[model samples]
Target: MSKSKRLMELMMTVNRMRKFTVRQLADQFDVSPRTILRDLQELSELGVPLYSEVGPHGGYQVLKERILPPIAFSEEEAVAMFFASHALRHYLFLPFEAESSTALQKFYYYMPGDVRDRIDQMKNRVDFLTHTRQQKAEYLGVLLEASVDQRVVTMQYETKNGYSERTIQPVGIYASNGFWYCPAYCFLRRDFRLFRCDRMQSVANDSTGIEPLDHRHIHLGNWEEHGSEKPVYIRMIVDLSREGVRRCESELWHVPHMDITPDGSGQLNQNVPSSELMYFAKFFIGLGNEATVKEPSELVECMKGILNEIMAKYD
Candidate 1:
């Protein structure tokens, strides 16, 4: 590595560990103590805020709260960061757009010449889909903060049936289909619920005096898939046609056991609790009439109701 690069790496090591003697640094970098001291002096002169302490435990340390200069990135590193930021820019609809653009510009400007040349050569070959429009950025920011802080929020949510005011403690934010969703514990229903971020008419941080629930008590993903209800096994018979086999193999649905006969006819046996049966039903709706629930009277009724609704639409 170049002297500047080696010095930058040493600076990072020292910053993370909080203290390192010149001898220790020399050993780490495989250099002489004199070279380590010279590098430290150069770094200090470059506004790195490195200080040396004297005594039994004395070593060089970057003072806390000091902002270090940006490290140089290789051409590959620059391109990778750019691509990551580009992907986020497309998927994330938030106030981060300007920040992402500025960071990308600064990265490209500081990158070494050879690295920059490689990035330029590959730039045209890398492109992402741009058809999707940007979403409200502030909503995402608020949802993220709520999830991290474990704070409750009050929002007016628009469901397919109608609108309702709700107070919920957000557990996490996830993307499904093309929209963002906040899975939270709803106060009104006294259960976990998923709220579409965009469909939220109004959202505000709630500071009212209510004891925050312990997040560890809830299974957020399972709650989102199947409410707080206990799971019950539901059996499904999936046809083993080419399309059916491929569909069952998809990660989107969880099928525990599937048996295929010599004739290509297959039985897909899934042990889904009542909690996730609705999700399974919604997923299988795309299979037309080929996917059938053979057992669990409740699930059969649910599927029949859904099919009835679809048939009604045609009638």
Candidate 2:
């Protein structure tokens, strides 16, 4: 093999072997021991974290952090990878925040000059925007690790009722609309619950020897499928004017359940979570006459109560 190919293969081989003698590598690569020793020196200079031990049974071994072998990417693929990491800069916290930054820097540092120039030129033109939030989900790494390992964790959580300690086995963590959420199986609630990551005051491994739920089948994408007994749902039917339909398409959660006509008018007929009726009332109220809630007397009553409070303020 050519010197470059041999070096690359040797890098991968040593990383996989983790510990090997120079003679072993030389024999495997059909190269001289002197050549293998020189290659090892070069790899060490390139930050491969090699450690040598002088004893009959001690061979060289890679340290805790192992360097990955180089992989070739097309120009387009390289740019796409760069922007994928760039888009994440908007988030305040990431599971691998420091590592992500370090990887992106290394990636950019090695790009060809023309590719770097192209990336610089396109930096301002393309962007993936998300809402900016100040609250940091500090335990995202812990939650993610628990999810992957399927281990239970104990955390002090800030709940709507009050602060409470919880033991949960996280299915996964996800980001949406500038917030991080972890859907986990809560031992306290005896069901699956979605916890906002920022609300977690502290997180640690469960030392009580709590048995973790079998959440290997669950993941962020499909945890809702195996969700616990769902909240009460209230049937809601609403008529939307053309303008209302246009607005709802952008902001309404039930847009997919809307029945639209040729004139762009639509009717939303779906069951909404009963706990969110007050929010729905406020939203429909903001729509003024553009929306007409046709059913679910509970929501109508809630809307009336809100309107009454507003009039009382005037009085």
Candidate 3:
């Protein structure tokens, strides 16, 4: 293989194995020890953080967290990737930051000088994120991989009550409000459910994978929401204020079907799952006096009860 491809393979190997000696890598790649040493040094120079030990118990190790293995991309695909990555910059604390950044770097390297210059000129003009990065979901990578490979996984998950173990067949993964969630068929629940990736302590293959490899085992409602609960129709009204506008945008991000008046007064009609009515109530209450719940007395009652508790603290 060419030296660049060989270097990429070497880096991938070290990352997967976590640690390996120069002799081991040399033998694996059918190269001499000196060549392996040279490649390791080259990788370090190219920004791969590698460390070595002198003793028999130690070898070489990659310093940072493991990202996806390197994959080549053509120039056209690189151009397309630049725009896509730019769009997702708002999700800064994305689980695959290292991998995506590396891919962007490769795209930049492959771009023609004029193309690179034109893109660079607009790079600062198009910004996605307003705030700083949040903590990344640690187990998102494992969940993502398992979903792709049809691997059933056992995750040590932290629920509302406490931590417990769950065997899940991941059907889909999504992100919203800065949190990542996986929709999976839970063996424990004997039903479809949603899991927060951040709340997972650990994830491992459940007996190699789901036997017979069935994707139909899990049922998800849409590309976004997950559940089989009956739908709840919500009617809400809002004031035409700055905060109202902001709330409208945020609510519209999740529930696009909500109808806003021509004068931008409020969202009139919304249909969400009964399971998510609490979520809906909280969203409206969060808008302060700018919002009003017109239908579903249960939601209004829930909001009133919560407000009463808050008022009781002062009175």
Candidate order by lDDT, highest to lowest? 2, 3, 1
Per-residue lDDT value at 245 in model 1: 60
Model 1 reaches what TM-score against the true structure? 0.59
Candidate 2 residue pairs in backbone clash = none
After superposition on all CA atoms, how large is the RMSD of candidate 3? 8.4
Q: What TM-score, over all chains together, does every model reach?
A: 0.59, 0.85, 0.65
Kindly indicate the candidate among 2 and 3 with the higher lDDT. 2
Q: For candidate 2, lDDT tens digit of each residue in 25-81?
A: 989999899999999999999889999999999889999789999999999999999
Estimate every model's Cα lDDT from 0 to 1.
Answer: 0.71, 0.90, 0.72
Candidate 1 on 180-269: residue-level lDDT in tens? 778888988988776778888888888676666777545445554546655566555555555666566653523347787776557777
Tell me the lDDT of model 3 at 56. Answer: 62
Model 3: per-residue Cα lDDT over 59-78, one tens digit each: 98888655456666665666
- Using alpha carbons, what is the TM-score of model 3? 0.65
Mark the 10 consecutive residues where model 1 has the least summed lDDT: 129-138
- Candidate 1: what lDDT? 0.71
